[model samples]
Every structure is written in structure tokens, then in C-alpha cells.
Target: MTDHATTFRRLHQEGLLLLANAWDAGSARLIESVGAKAIATTSAGLAWSNGYADGDTLPVERLYAAVESIARAIRVPLTVDAESGYSDDPAAVGATIARLGALGAVGINLEDGDGTPEALCAKLDAIKRACAQAGVDLFVNVRTDIYLRGLAPEGERVGATLARARLYRDAGADGLFVPGITQRTDIADVVAGTSLPVNVLAYPGLPAAAELAQLGVRRLSAGSGLSQTLFARAAELARGFFRDGDSAPLSAGAMPYPEINALFAQR
Candidate 1:
């Protein structure tokens, strides 16, 4: 646990946190196979797996179960996207964080300032109290979605961005995740606003990895992009099969028969 704490805290260096969001144990292990520093659970990813909405539709129990399965599959530090902390209550958020700790979640990303900024604040307050009551050193990476889903009309993404960043920081957030922060100036402003390391989502036609590092972005999450891309690729392949009306390339690059047997080779 201490090791994960140090690692989660160390992303502030020039080093980048290549956090690949996973949906299940298979995906989690596959990411670990290719070498990812840590794993972040995407609510959308998990929701799709369970056939639900991307928001807080998934029951708390099911979410924790997914985290437990992923934790068992990977060796790296696991960060969970505890969407809205399951409820608006602070005690619930803290209880959820404690449950995550029991299942091996070393870090958590709690978002506030979505619409009711006061509610977000209340939830973060609960998370802090719960983490303390539970005696778990869960690094709460408080995410503020104002810039991403709630842009302003006066072209003040920067203003809204800075305001919410400070709000979460003061609410006991260990780090800040500012989604939709594409502009260099906006990201720089967020970094300047708070001492917490800023997390940015990977977007198309945006700055490169080097650029984000230059802007002081320590943690970079793929968010739902990876899952969306995989879904698009699968759709394309499925359409290809429908057009071909016969055998396709699905089995061409698939694991060999021996590899299939290897799933149970060493238990």
C-alpha cells in the first residue's frame, strides 16, 4: 500500500503516468502484459461491460466487484473511478473508498463541481472523513469536469477551470483531474492554481505527450477513449464479417490453440 502511495504521488516528476483504463480482469491483465505503470478503472468501461449507463448506474456492489477482479489480475497500483462517490453523501463516499481499499484499490478519483458544485464539495468532504475513519491511505484524485462537460458561454473555460480546480483542492483532493483542458494556457493555469498534480485526458488533435509534460501534466489518463476506440474497431470488424458473409480475419491474429489451452495451464 505504501509502495502504491509513493508511486501515485511520484507522477508529478517529469515522468508520465501511462494510465490505461480497463473494464475487466482480462483487459487489466492485457494492459499489464504490455507494461503500464498503473491501471485506472473507467466507469464507462465498466458500465458497458455490465450493460448500463456510463454514469452512476452501476450499483456500488458491482463496481467494487469489478475493481476486485481487476486488482486480482494486475500487479500495478490500481486507481478506481468512483463515479460521484456512488452517492452525494460524504459518508457513503468514504465508505466506498474504504471498501475499495479492502479490494486493493490504492488510489481513487472523485469528481465534483459537475453541476451542483456544493454537492461535489460535500462528497469530497465525506471522502476525506471516510478515508480517515477507515484508516486507508487512498490517494483521492479529485476530478472536476467543468471544463469538459460544462464549458461557459463567455469563452471562460479558463475561468471555470481555475475556479473548480481550486474548489477541489481545498476540499482535500490529493490531485486535480481537469478533463477537456486542451489549451496550453488553460492547463498551465490549472497547474498554477493548485499544487496538486493535474491530470488531463487524451484527446484527438490535441497536444502531444511532450507538450503535456511541458505544461506540467504529470498524470495522463486515456479515459474512455481507449474503450471507445476498441468498440469502433470491433464494429468495423463485425461489419466486415457481415459483408464477407463467411470466414473473416478474427482468428488470423488470435492466440494459438496452445495459448488457448494455456489459460488453464498454470493455476
Candidate 2:
């Protein structure tokens, strides 16, 4: 925790902390080889990869297994997306997060979803206490879905998010993640309105990283886009192979087996 937490926190304050979210150990290692500063797991990606639908339905044990595998394979600080803390009980959620800390995770994304701000703050407080008890400085990234869930009217979205951001921060959050925000003005408003580091999702056609940084974004996440794209390609290849018996798509833009296999080898 000492080695990773300090670095992960420093990254958010310095420059853009771009995370190529991984669903498995293989993806974590691959992203690390390409020089990702940290590893973040996409709950949606993890669910899809594990044959479950994206939602708050992922079992904590399965999530732990995925994180454990990735933790063992990568040296970079890892942040797991623990959607809604996976439980309504704040203590249960905190215990689960503490388990992640033991597995070498430096941070977690605990979303509020459509839940109340008070409830999410309770979870944040509990998680902070659990981390302290465990002697781990886990970066609790509180994700507010006011925009994503349409919890407020268009005119009131920014204010709603800001209000929740302050509550989460007061409850012990280290960062704020607002996924549905794309507009530069709205982004700047959120940044100026909050003391926590702001993280935004990389939606299609959104501004580039340079533009986002100028808007005061401290982190950018690819969410489940990478997994969706990768799996989409696999489905396309399978469809083509069965329909036309053409294997050409198999070799197109695919990394060589040996190169990929080398990623797991001892360095």
C-alpha cells in the first residue's frame, strides 16, 4: 500500500492519470507493457468477461478473484471499480474494500448510482475507517451518477453533482468521478466546484486528453469501451469464419501469440 498509494495519489495531482481499464490479468499485463501508469478494472468489463451482465450483480468473491489475478501480474497501482460497494450495508462494503487493499489494490471507484447522497457518504465513511484499521491508504474514489442517471434536470445537473462531490469528499473520498460529463464548460464547472481530483469517462467524440487537461481533469478512464470493442471484434471474426470460412480476419491487427505470452513471463 505504501509503495502504490503514494504514487497513485501523486499521479492525480501532477498530470492526467489515464487508465486503460482492464477486466482480467492478461489485459492488465498488456496495458502495463504499453506503459500505463496505473491499472483500473471496469466492473462492466469484468462482468462481461466473466459471463455476467454489467450491473451491480457482480459477486464480491468473483471480483476479488479477478483483482487478485491482476494484482499478482502487475506492479502498477490497481484501482477496482466496486460498483455501489456491492452491498447496501456500509460495514459490509467497507470490509470488502479492505479485502481489496489486502490484495494490493491502491484504490477503488465506489459509485452512488441512483442511491441517495447520504447513503453513499455513509459507505465512504465506513470504507475510510476500514482502510485506516487495515493500515492501508486506499484512495476512495467516489463516483457520482447524478448526470449519468439523470437524477437532476439538465439545468441543475452540475449543481447536483457538485453538492454530492462535497459530501463524498467530506466523508473521506480522495477523488471524484463524473462519467456522463463531456462538455468542457460543464467539466470546468465541476473542477472549480470541488476540491477533489476530477475524473471523466472517455465517451465517443469527447474532447481529447489535452483538451480535458486544460479543463482541469485530473484523470480519464476508458470505462468498458476497450472490452466492448475487443469482444465486438471477436464476435465479428467468429461470424465471418462461420459464414464464409474466411480466416483472414483472425490475423488482422492481432498481436502475435509469443509477444502476448511474454507479458506473463518473469521480467
Give the clash count for each candidate: 1, 0
List, residue by residue over 70-184, the lDDT tens digit for candidate 2.
9999999999999998899999999999999998899999999888999999998889899889887798888999878889998899999999998888899999999988877
lDDT of 1 by residue, 36-137 (tens): 888898889989988888878898888988988888777788899887887766777778888898788988887764556677777778777777777777
TM-score, candidate number 2? 0.98
lDDT of 2: 0.91
Candidate lDDT scores, in order, read 0.79, 0.91
TM of each candidate vs. truth: 0.91, 0.98
True-vs-predicted CA distance for residue 27, candidate 2, Å: 0.5
Off by over 4 Å in 1: 255-267
Using TM-score, give the best candidate's number.
Answer: 2
Residue 2 of model 1: what lDDT?
72
